[model samples]
Target: MPLCLDPNGNRCSYWPQDAHFVWEKNGQKIETCVSEQTHVLADGRVHVLTWIKDAVVQDSQYCCLVSSKAGNKMSTSYISVEGSNNQDSWSRGFASWKSIISEHDKLMTNWKKTWESCNKKDIV
Candidate 1:
C-alpha cells in the first residue's frame, strides 16, 4: 500500500507502498491507504491533510520542537544607527524592512535545502 494525498481536501487513508514516499507541499493533496483520515503533522510541522493519526495527536509538542529547531537554525543581525539628522535616520528606518525580507528569504532557502536532503530516497 502506498500513501496518497487527497486531491479534493477530504480525509483519506495511507499505507506505505515501499520504503519511500512523495513530498507534497502546502495546499497540495496526497493519496494514501490508511483507513482513518486525520490531520497530519510531519517532522513537527503541521500539514493540512495528514494521514498519520499520531502526527495529528502529537502536533503541539512537535510544533514546539520544530519551532525550537527553526530558531536555532536562524541567525539575526540587527544594526542600530543614530543619525545626526532626521532625514538620515528616516531613510535607514525605511530600508530596514528590505533587510528583514532578505533574511527571511535566506532562511527559507536553507530550510528547503535541508528538507530535500532529508527526504531523498530511491523508489523501486
Candidate 2:
C-alpha cells in the first residue's frame, strides 16, 4: 500500500496546499521545481503538486513529507535512470543487503576470471 492515503483508503489524489509537501532526494531536502497556482478545490484545499525537472539524470531515492492540520505523512520512492545498468537494484541511498551481495559476487567473478587468465600456462 502507498504511504499516503485518503479517508476512503485510496492513494491521495490531490494534495492540498495547506498540507505542505516537502520533497527530498537521497535524504537531502530539495528546493527546486516548486511552482504554485491560484486554483483551489471545492473543499477549500488549494491543489499542490511538486515536480522535479530532468529527474532521470541519475538513480535516486526520493521522499515526500506532507504536513497538515490532521497529521503528517511521508512517502518514499526509489527512481532509477531509465538506462541504468543496475535498475533492478534499489537506489544507491536505499541499497539493500541483497544488492550489496550481488555486486560483491559480480566483482568476485570478474576478479576470478582475471586471475585465471593471468595464471594460465601454455602447454607444449
Candidate 3:
C-alpha cells in the first residue's frame, strides 16, 4: 500500500523537507516494510509517497501521519480482502470496537511525537 501527501498549505511554494511522518498498522507502529519518496510537481506541490511493501493480505487498518510547521494531518485506511471467509468477516466486525479504541489511542500518541519532532528547532 502507498500513501501520498501534499505538504503545501496556503503557501503554494512551501517545501517542508523537514516534515515528520509515521506509519502504523492495527494501532502499532510499523517497524518494517516501509519506504518513502518525495516529488516536486510542476505546480509547486510537494508530493510525498510512502509505501508499505510485503504487507500480508488481511483485514487490517493502516494510518499515515505527517507533521511539519505547515501543519499536522492524519489519514486512515482499512484494507479488507475481497471474497474472504464470511464467518471471519462477521467475527471481525463484532469484535472490532476494542481494537478501534486501541488504535485511536496509539495513533494519538504517535502523532504527538511526530508533531513535537517536526516542530523542534535549534536552540541557537
Candidate 4:
C-alpha cells in the first residue's frame, strides 16, 4: 500500500481511480469502498495501495490491472479475505468459478439421460 504526506509532511492515504481498482466475489462485482487505493509515483511506479474502507474479510477477489497500447498487457495480485464470522464460506467457495453455466448444463444433461433411461414401466 502507498502512503502520502500532508502539507506538514504528515502521513496520509491515497485512493486509486476506478480504472485501476476492481473487486469481485462469486463472479459478481462488489463495492470498492476505499479511502485510498493506489499511489503512483512520477516514474509511473505504483508505490502503495490502501483499501481500508468498508473492507471485510471474506472469500473475494482483488485485482490491480494496468494496460497500455504500447504493448497491451495486464497484471494482478490475489489476496484471500478471510473473516472470523465464517459466513461467506458455502455460498461463495470456489476460488475461481469458470464457465459455471456450461458445467451445470453438462451435469444436467447427463442426469436427464440417466433419469430417462430408468423408465418406470421397464423397471426390473
What is the clash count for each candidate, in the order shown?
17, 0, 0, 9
Predicted model with the maximum TM-score: 3
User: For model 3, how does the per-residue alpha-carbon lDDT over 1-124 read when each residue is reduced to its tens digit?
Assistant: 2333444434444556557778898899986888887676767676777878655566788898988788889999988877554767778876897799899999999998887877785322
The residue-level lDDT of candidate 2 at 96 comes to 75
Model 2 ranges off by over 4 Å: 1-18, 43-46, 86-124
lDDT by residue for model 2 over 1-124, one digit each (tens)? 1144455555454653256778788988888885433444554434555556545677889888878777898989998777677655556635677688899999999998887877785322
TM-scores, one per candidate:
0.26, 0.43, 0.52, 0.29
Off by over 4 Å in 4: 1-54, 83-85, 88-124
Decoy 2 TM-score against native: 0.43
Question: Scored by CA lDDT, what does every candidate get?
Answer: 0.40, 0.67, 0.74, 0.50
CA shift of 23, model 4, Å? 6.1
Error of 4 at 101 (Å): 41
Model 3, poorest ten-residue lDDT window? 1-10
Comparing 1 with 4 on TM-score, the higher-scoring candidate is 4
The C-alpha local distance difference test score for the whole of candidate 2 amounts to 0.67
Q: Which of the numbered candidates is closest to the native, going by highest lDDT?
A: 3
Writing each residue's lDDT as its tens digit, candidate 4 over 1-124 gives 3355444555533332223444444455546564444545554444544453445465445543333233323344455665645655644655335468679889999988877788755753
